[model samples]
Every structure is written in C-alpha cells, then in structure tokens.
Target chain A: MIEFTIWDILRNLLLAARWTVVLSLVSFLGGGIVGALLLFLRIGGNRLSTAFTKYYVEFFQGTPLLMQLFLAFFGLGLFGINVPAWLAAGIALILWTAAFLTEIWRGSVESVVRGQWEASASLGMGYVQQMRYVILPQALTVAIPPTVGFSVQVVKGTALTSIIGFVELSKAGTVVTNATFQPFTVYGLVALIYFALCWPLSKSSQILERKLNVAHRNH
Target chain B: MSLIEITDVRKSFGQTEVLKGIDLDVKPGEVIAVIGKSGSGKSTLLRCINGLETIDGGSISVAGAQLLPDEAHLKALRLKVGMIFQQFNLFPHLTAGGNVILSQTVVKKTPKREAEAMARKMLERVGLAEKFDAYPDELSGGQQQRVAIARALAMQPIALLCDEVTSALDPELVAEVLAVVRELAAEGMTLLMVTHEMKFARDVCSRVVFMHQGRVHEIGRPEEVFARPKTPELRQFLGVQ
Candidate 1:
C-alpha cells in the first residue's frame, strides 16, 4: 500500500489547476480574436466571405469537440507533425470556442433594430462608421451577459482537453487518486476546485444581465 | 430654383409597386407635407429623397448633389438633408448630448469640443437643455423624438424630411414634438413631412401634397387643398367627399 498524504494530493491538484486556468485563458482570448473576425465577416462582409464564415462556423459546431481534439492529437501525427498535448488542446479548443462565439455575437448584432441602421445612414454614416458609432456599441451591451455565460461552458470544456493527455484538473485528480488510493477525497477536492473557478462567472453573468436590462427600462 | 427635384421616381418591393413614376419639386424654405393612405407610398417618397431607399427609376438631385449609384455623391446629399422618423430612432447607448454630437464630430469633422458645444445649443433649441446626460431609454417618447430632432438640426442641413414624426406619440405628447417642428418651420428651414396630423400640416405647411395610388394626386396651398380638394383621391384623403 502507498502512503500518500492528503496535503501532498491537494498541493499536486492545485498545481494542475494552474494549467486549467492558463488553458482556459488562452482559448478564450484566442477564440475572442478569431470570433470577432468571424462576426464581421458573418455580418457585413462580402457575399463570398459571408458564406465562408457560415461554413466555418457550422463545421466546428456540428462536430463533437472531443473528436476534434483527438484529430488534433493523433491526426496531425499521421502527417508527421508531432505536436504536444497542450498545443493540440489549445488549437482544438480555440476553434471550437470561435465557432460558438461567432454565432452568439451575430445574433446580438442582428438584434439591434433596423431603425438604428436607417437613422445612422440618414445621417451620412457609412457601413463601418455606423457599426463603430452605433451598431456595435449597442450590440455589445446585449452581448456581454451571454458572452460571460458562455465563458462557464468554456471553462468546463477545458476539462475535455485532459482526454488528449493535457494534465489539467481532471487529469491531476486521476493521478492523485491513483497515488493516494482515496477516490472520494481526491475527486471531492477536484470538484471543489472547478466550482471555485466557475461559480462566480455564472452568478455574475446573471446579475450583470439583470442590471443592464433594468438600466434600459422605460421611465 | 428647387432645393430638391424628383422626376418620374419609381419604387417597388418585389411584386408591389409602392411609388409609381412620381414627380415633385421642393423649393428653398418651402414647408411641404405629404399626406395619403397607408399604402400610398408617401413614406417611400420621403425615403427616396433622403437616399434611404434607392429609386427604381428617374432622378433625385438635392443641393447640386445627385443620388446616383455613387456612394460619395449620395453621402454628400445625406449630409445636406436631415431626416427624422416617426419612431425617433435616437441612439440608446449615448446620452442626449452624445447623440447630437456624434454626426457633428464624425460626419462633419467638427472638433469634439465644438461639436459638444453645438450639441448643447441644439438640445437647448429643442428645449431639452437640462437632459444632456440622459440616455434615450430614460426619456419619454416626446423627449426622445426631440433629442432626435436635435441630432438632425446639429447637422445644419439644407432641409429636413420628417416621416410621420409624431405618429408614434400619445395624443398628449404629440403636441410637444409638433411644437418643435412648428418652430423649425418658423425659422424657414425647408421642411418636408409625411404626417397624418392634418391640422399641423395646415398650420405649418405652405403647400400640401396629397398622394394616392403611388402618385402626387394633388398639390396646392394648404387652405385650398384641405378646403377644396380637386381630385376624388384628395377629397377622400381629406374625408370631405
């Protein structure tokens, strides 16, 4: 029998939790950059670019993200491009996040009234100018709550990266459990760590969404 | 010379022909009100004048700038012609002052300070001087419309085209917005409006255009048109037949 103390297991799990935090950030920020470009293309871009973005979004979202990670891990090696688990996980998660986010943001942009576009045009604003001055700012307010809410899913999705051998919270739990032979204790702490990361995000998203709506209520 | 000229203008949405070969001329300082039934293309005609809707046929030229397919040319015309809507359409994200200041600074290239100064002055003109910092959603319907008017006037346009500007207001609040329009008319701003409020048109408009079946069925002095409509369409529109 192994003599692995609870303190040692907690400390190791905490170290692995750092990777989860970093992975979530890299994917979220990278997805945001890619998603914003997709948003512009989906909304106001040319016909060809618009179609291109549509297919791109559908491709990632329609498929399972775990399968995509598997391809990033094993599929790339078939072509002799050997990448690390972090690199494979990073790329897969970003693409998956971008696809979902582009659709989310496009819905927000379209929700702005037709009159806003007309009023802006009547004042001599060009397409980009209207977006910069009126449309995007208004859409951003509508987008914030759902976007923050989506972040919770993003954090949870990072757990899937561990299947491709990325040593995040879940993988760390398994390792600590194998060493300590204490499944309930080790897994309980893992769940607590994830809850600590995710709870405030979901709670604040609801609060801010309510606050924004109340602020816009008619006098 | 006319400030705005439309010759044989046509517009259609798919199978429906909204404006069929309409011609109109608006001279400087002329206050013209276009009145008609719901589907008679009055709104479409106003939209065409501002380049909000592209004309299917004929020419629209305002202030020496023609409404061609040319983007630069149309934008020039838009700058010269201010428009207000029935819905007010004030930018919700900005304060009342910011709404007025945006086009001034962005479109007209006025410096930020000067634009803010002009916005405050225009808000004062609309009798909303104290609400510079209030957002549109915070204001009442009449107040929001007034902010929209201030936004348009901030552009110092050659003429204004208002599309049922008070149609969305409550009867009580309608008076407040109409007062602002009346003051603009008194100032001799070339005003073209699409309205159902016959009394406001009669009092403020120099000439009235009664539209029916996508054409200007009648045009004359407001008194003559309202009192003695020559065409059956105008008579029916005035409800005197």
Candidate 2:
C-alpha cells in the first residue's frame, strides 16, 4: 500500500463534485420543463389527464430515490436495453424531481381563487387566454418559493445517483475512503461541500417566502 | 328592440334549484334592481344574463344574439355585458389600471394607447384616477369596488350587471360606490343591480325585482314594489306591518 496525502483526496473529490453539480443542473432543468407540462394537464385537462398526473406523482414520491436509481440502472437491462450509469442516474433523478415539482406547482395554481377564473371568463377570455394572462401571473408569485426550495432537494438527491456508479462526489468520496483509510476526513469534507451548495439556496428560499407573505399582507 | 331578454330561464346546483324559470326584459337605458334575502337567487340571475352561469332551462338573448353554451358565443356575449362582483375581484397581481385595461385589450383588441386612455377616463369616472397604479390590496374596500366598476365600464358594454357591488363595503363606503352606480345610471348605461341597499334601490332603480326562494315574487316600479308590495311574501320581505 502507498502513503496517501489529504491533497490527493481533496483534489479527487473536488473533481468529482463537478459531475455532481452538472447532474443536478441537468435533472433540475429537465424536470422543470416536464413538471410544467404535468401541472398544466393536472389543472386544465379532463378527468383522464388528472388521473394520469396523479399516478405519476404517486409513483415517484411514494418510492425511495435510491430504489428509483437502482430500477433505472438495472431494470432496463432486463428488457435488453443497456443504459450507461450516468444516463440511468440522470433519468431517474429527472423523473423523481418532476414528480415533486408537479405537485408543488399544482398547489400554486389551485391557490388562485375561483373568482379569478370567473373574472377572466367574464372578460371573454378562452381557457388558454385566461391561464396565460390572469391565472399564471398570479400563480407564479406562489410558485417561486417552492421552486427555489425544491432545488435544494435536487442537489441533495444527486447523492443517490452515485450508488449506480455515476462517479459523482459521493462515489468519489467512497473510493478515497477505501484507498486512504480516512473515512472521517473524506466524508466530513463531502458533507461540507454539500452544505456549501445547499445552505444558501435554503436561506434564500426562506427569505423569498417571507417577502411574498409580506407583500400579500400589505395587499 | 330590448337590449336584454331572458325567457323561462332556470339553473340548479346538484339538486338545489337556484333559478326557477325566470322571465324578464330590459329596454335601452333601463336600470333594474334585484333584491332578495340570502340564497334567493338574485346573484344567480345576474350571472346567467352575462353567461357566467349557464341556464338549465331557457333562452337569454343579449344585443340580438341568442346566448348559447358554446364557448365562442359566450365570449361574444361577454364583450357586451360587463359585471361587477361583491368581492370586487380585481386581479391582485395587477395595478388598478392593468385590471381595467385587460378586457379592453384582450377582448376588445383595442390598441394599447387607446386602452390606457379609456382606462384612465373610466378610472376618472369612478373617482380613482389618482389610484391608477395601486394594487387591489393597497386600496380600501370602497376604492377596490370603484376600481372594479371602472374595470367593467372600460369594456363599454351595452348593459352592466352588479352583483351586490356594495355589500362588502363598510357602511360609510357603501354610499361612495352607490354614488358611482347612480352616476352611471344617470348617464344612460343600462344597469341591472343585485343589492341589499333599500334606499338606493328605492331612489335610482327604474324597476325593482323582488325574488324569493328561487323565484321572482314580484316585479314593477320601485314605488309599486316598495309602497304597495302586492304579494304577501314581498310585503313581509319589505317588513311592511
């Protein structure tokens, strides 16, 4: 066995952190676009649309994210489809993120009172026009805090992707721990990096929530 | 020709009948006040006329077009029938001028500059020209209602429906909103108001409709309904000893 230095461990984990960050961004942006579509279907579509969105939310939210990653990585192989670890992990994270996001957005849309819909309808606005002009502008105010808050979850969720050999920060930490026999030091740094990434977003979301509440109160 | 005509109209929610076979007509420049106790269907009748509430059992024609359940026709009908709500449902995200200009630009397809000018004029009419940029929550109940009236009038509708427009206002503020309505009445904008303000109804209404238990119990001039009250239900409703 060779002697190991702290610099070696730190530099390796730091390089892996880039992949974690990239994965989180890809999953978040993909999830947001898909979540928006699910939210629109949940609100404006007929009964079948509502049912489909409901089941989609339940399936992802009810299962553990680790299990979802396992399924995405291994389950597809059963069907003769060999997906790379990174693609499997990213796809699973996107699906899971979309589930929670769709539910979060649905709540925001529903919080707009029935009277706003009536007022828009009374203006001779069709359903799409009403949603575009009246309902969405109001719903966006309620949507921002949750959406920002949800980003933290997406960041934290990237840890689970490492279980499928994605070579992200957590996986890199495990490799360094096994090689250097420094579990405490390596894991501690990993925790700190995650905190550095997520803490500011958490604080900013709380601040935004308070500001929106104050704006509403003043109104 | 009558500006609005409703014949044998009916509406129900689940098993509860809210509007039971109603008939009425409004000629040009008529101001009709509909009064009844809570759950008496006065608001329902007004909503039906504007195609906001679908009628279960009859015909409503506004400005010579027969009102149907088709979305396109309803949109056409809405352009000619403005409505004000008791809650003063101005868009909270929008400034007062934004609320007023929305229908003008979106439905009427009026040019932006023209819509703003018209919104300004209507706001001036409602005594809210100074509050053109204020949000709904920033305004008092009375001011919001005035802005709501301005929002409705910006459409330049042939007829206006007010559903208890002042019921949410403070007693002190009620007169200010009613004053706006009275001014609109005097300017020959055909008006149908659902109100609990008896004195305002007695003074400004060209006709009074007394509704009770989902039906029209009486309809005539304000003096006839307030003074004579032909039906026992109307007499008891007006608290005639």
Candidate 1 stretches greater than 4 Å from native: none
Which 10 residues in a row give candidate 1 chain A its minimum summed lDDT? A210-219
Q: TM-score of every model?
A: 0.97, 0.98
The models' CA-based lDDT, in order, is: 0.92, 0.91
DockQ of every candidate:
0.63, 0.68
Considering every candidate listed, which one attains the maximal DockQ? 2
In terms of lDDT, which candidate is strongest?
1
What is candidate 1's CAPRI-style docking category based on DockQ? medium
Off by over 4 Å in 2: none
Candidate 2 chain A: 10-residue stretch with minimal lDDT: A210-219
